[model samples]
Target: MSQKRLLLWVFHSFTLIAGIQFLQYYIFYNSSYPFPYTANLVNSFGTFYTYLLLLPLVFYSAKSAFSNLENRVQRMLLLVLSGLLVSMLHLFVMHFVNWLQIYQWTEDPFWNSYRFLISKWLHFELIAYFLFVLAWRFLVFEKKGSEASKPEYWTQIKVKEAGLVSFVPVEEIRWIEAYDNYIKVRTKKDKFHLVRMPLREIEAKLDSGHFKRIHRSTIVAIREVVAIHQDNGQYRVLLEDNSTLKLSRTFKKSIEDSIRV
Candidate 1:
């Protein structure tokens, strides 16, 4: 997994407990029935604790579902199975907690509380599982759709706010300069931002005909180059607009070969 994805998972897990607590409070405070404070609190804590205990289960399930499978149908099956497993785990924990409560305190001898808790468990687990699956689909797989289609206009263009829109057409954007979080597109317009996609993902979608990596931080458009000249130990690509694009030696041979052909 990439660093960003790892960080996102950590954030999601951390916030999940707080979200469950908030939801529990909302339900209790807004309810018509006399709130069973102790019982509801116990159930909420159980939900939180169970989810924590099942962290590894969910992670491994999601990982296995999405990993090393070239076949789309097989991957989808694994994903469905993983989601089912998570929901089942949630249900089991809810029932197990109800059994404990029944054995501990007979003051409130009502099965409705157990049923309500189980419903909550099902609701939260299903939503979380669905989110997990959707997140994996978006991050792990590049779906084919209209977004991948090419536009007829090729030459002159303009981009909006540098941070909001990525003006670097996939074809014109050769490489990018990735900063702490943002990336600057080195397009025919020079280094500008027309999109906010991560550097790695953008690199994946770029057509090899027009762009490729020259450095960890740089990607250059092939058609933009007017000439490439050796500069000491490194290289420089002069574009048709007279702006220079850097070319590391690692990528020099490929660019040279492209130019030769």
Candidate 2:
């Protein structure tokens, strides 16, 4: 995540925590709660402040633990582990702060307080972790959907061949072939240009509807496909230049759909 985004989350979380704690304290103060006003206020403020101090660690760990995890079981395990670690850290810091306030860092009383706090706050801490993860996932999903809906207009691709630089217009390109650590750009005029870039990287820059990957080694422009021939359960893509390229069974359906559309 970018520093700006991290800072924005921190600010928003702080505001949310503060607002909730304030309302909670106000409700308790007005109600017939048994707890003393001073003690209630102290605990409320302490809990909120403790979470504010731990926000960075929690956010960083949650992002690292949940991001890119595809397995459901493994992701759940990591989430539980991360939540436990964050809760333990929060408990330790809260106790240390309390000890500082009382000027007593003794062992027995600290352990007792720690146990009590854990028993009372553990479930809440886990819930907080899940809530944060849900919000982060929602934001990411929305960002991806917004990007996918935007139109892509690629004009040209810059290519360097033999120490000479040139710009190839997107429409003139007929097909592209993958070479080891590079790609061979083929134009409609039957000219070939070598570019030192991966075909997958180049593919991402092209219009998705216009260019389709027919095989691991070939990506053909949809407009340049003259015909598709199938024989013996295999397919051949015939391009406008009369060049035949093998169409992998994996991408055959996608290529056919794009052409049909």
TM-scores of all candidate predictions against the true structure? 0.41, 0.53
Highest TM-score model number: 2
Find the candidate with the highest lDDT and give its number.
2
lDDT of 1 by residue, 1-261 (tens): 542564467566756765678576767673653445555666666655666566556656666665567787997787677776778767777667766755345564446555665566666777877775566446543342234555443332245583553334465654566776666765544566644456676666656566666667777777766688877767888767777767888888887777766
Cα lDDT, model 1, residue 194: 43
What candidate 2 gets wrong by more than 4 Å, as runs, is 1-42, 66-79, 95-108, 137-167, 175-208, 212-220, 224-256
In model 2, state the lDDT of residue 221.
Answer: 92
Candidate 2 lDDT tens digits, 35-74: 4555455555676667766666665665665566778888
**lDDT agreement with native, every candidate:** 0.63, 0.77
